[model samples]
Target: MASTKKTTAAKVQAPIDNRETFVSLQKSFADSDMPVEEKLKTLYQLQAADSEIDKIIQLRGELPAEVAALEEEIADLKERSAAISAVIDQLNRNIADAKLAIAEHESIIEKYQRQLETISNSREYDSLNKEIENQELLRQIGEKTINDTRMEISSKKSELEDLKDRLSIRTEDLAAKKTELENIVEETAKEEAVLRERREECAAKIDARTMSAYERIRASVHNRLAVVGIYNGDSCGGCFNTITPQRRVEIVSNKKLIICEHCGRIIINPDFAQ
Candidate 1:
C-alpha cells in the first residue's frame, strides 16, 4: 500500500519511466537503432556536414564583396574610357575646324598677293601687303592649334587603351573566382543531401517536448549540447560538475527526470551498478 501510494504520487506529478513510451521514443530515432558507436558516428557525420555547409555559405557570401569591388573597378575603368573617348572626339573636331580655318586663310593670302601685284598707289600696296601678312599670321595660328589637338587626341587614346587592358584582366579574375565558388558548391551537393536526410530522421524520432527542451538549452549554450551523461561520483560528463548527494540518490533511484544544476542539462544516468 505504501509503494502504491508513492506510485500514485509519481503518476500525478508526471509519468515517470513509462517503458513503452521510452521504447517508442527511442525507436523513433534512427540513431537509437544503431549501436552506440555507430550512433556517435552518424551524429558526428551530421555535425561535420552541417559545419561544412555553413562554412561554404559563409565563403560564398564573402566572395560577393570581392566580386562587387572588382566589378566596380571595371565599371570605373569603362567610364574613364568613355570620358577619354569623348575628349578625343572633341579634339578631332577641333582639329578639323582648325584645318578649315587654315585653308580659308591661305585662300585670302593668295588673293591678296594677286591684288598687290596690280596696285596703283604705294598706300594701297602697303594695305594689301598688311592684309596678306595678317592672313599668314592667322594661318600659322590655325596650324599650331591643329598640332596641339592632334597631340591631345593621341594622349587620350593611349590612356583609354591602358584602362581597357586593366579592366579586361580584372573582369577575367572575377569570373574565375565565381567559377571556383560554384564548383565547390556543386562538389559538396551529395554530402549536403545526406546530412539533410539524416537530420530529418533525427527530428522525427525525438519527442516534441524533449526536442523543445533540447533546442531551448542548446540555443542558450555555446557548445550546442542539451544532453549529458553522468560519470564517476555523479559528475556530469559535459561540465564535470559534481551532483549533490541528495540529487545523486534521487537520480540513482530513477524516481523522476533529473537535470544538472550547474549546466542545466538533461542528465542520462547510466546504470553503472549493473
Candidate 2:
C-alpha cells in the first residue's frame, strides 16, 4: 500500500502578525494547531454579525434616497423660478423703453401739426400732413408693444407663483424624510457598532485566504451566506442540496474543511445552525 507512508510534514509557522502576505497566511493556517471546527465556527460567527448589520440597514428602508430626490426636485423648481423672474424683469424694462418711444412719437406729431398752421403753399401743407400721419402710426405701434409686454410679464409671474408653490412642497417633503432617516440611524448606531466589533474579532481568527473566499461568496450570492451547516440530516444548509452519506461523515468529523459542491459555501456541523 503506497498510501500507508503518507504523512503531513510539520513546518515551523510564524506567529500571525495580521500583516502576513496572502500566500503566507494560507501556509500559516495550514501549519498551525488550530482545530478546523474552531475555524468554521469563527467564519459562521462573522457571517452572523454581518447579517445583523444588514438587517439594521434594512430598517431604514428607502428614506435616504427619497430625501435626496426631494432635495433635487426642490432645487430644480427654485432654478426655474429664478429664470422666470429674470424674464419678467427684462419684460418690464422693455415696457419702459416702449413708453419712452411713444412719448417721442407724440412730440413729433405735435410739432408737425403746428407747422401745418404756418404753411404758405400746397406743397408745405402736404409734407406736414404726411409727417403727422407717420408719427401717429408710430405712436400706435409703441402702445401695442407696451400692452403685449405687460401681458407676457403677467403670464410669467403666474408661472413663477406655481413654481414657488411646488418648491415649497418639495422642500417640506425633504425635511420630513431627512428627519425619519436620522431617527433610524440614531436608533441603530449603538447596536451596529457593537456588532461590527464582534465581526472584527471573528474575522481576525480566520486566515486571509478563507476570509477572501467568504467575502467573494457573500458578494456573489443573493442571501449573502458564506458559511452554513447541514440541514435535515441529509442536505446542505445553504443550497438545500442532498448530501451523500460519505460527505456527511467528513463534515461531521470537522477534521478537514468541507465545501458544498453545489453552492461553494463552507459546510459545518449542524449544531451551529441553531
The 0-to-1 C-alpha lDDT of every candidate, in the order given, reads 0.65, 0.78
lDDT of model 1 at residue 240?
Answer: 72
Which ranges in model 2 have alpha carbons more than 4 Å from their true place?
A: 1-41, 55-70, 205-209, 219-223, 229-242, 245-256, 269-273
Count of backbone clashes, every candidate in sequence? 1, 0
Over 54-138, each residue of candidate 1 has an lDDT whose tens digit, in order, gives 5556666666777788888888988888999888888988988999999999999999888888889999999888888899999
Q: How many clashing pairs in candidate 2?
A: 0
> Candidate 1: how many backbone clashes?
1
Q: Looking at model 2, report the run of 10 residues with the lowest lDDT sum.
A: 8-17
State residue 103's C-alpha deviation in candidate 2, in Å: 1.7
Candidates in order, TM-scores: namely 0.62, 0.72
For residue 62, give model 2's deviation from the true position in Å: 6.4
Q: List the residue pairs that clash in candidate 1.
A: 28-205
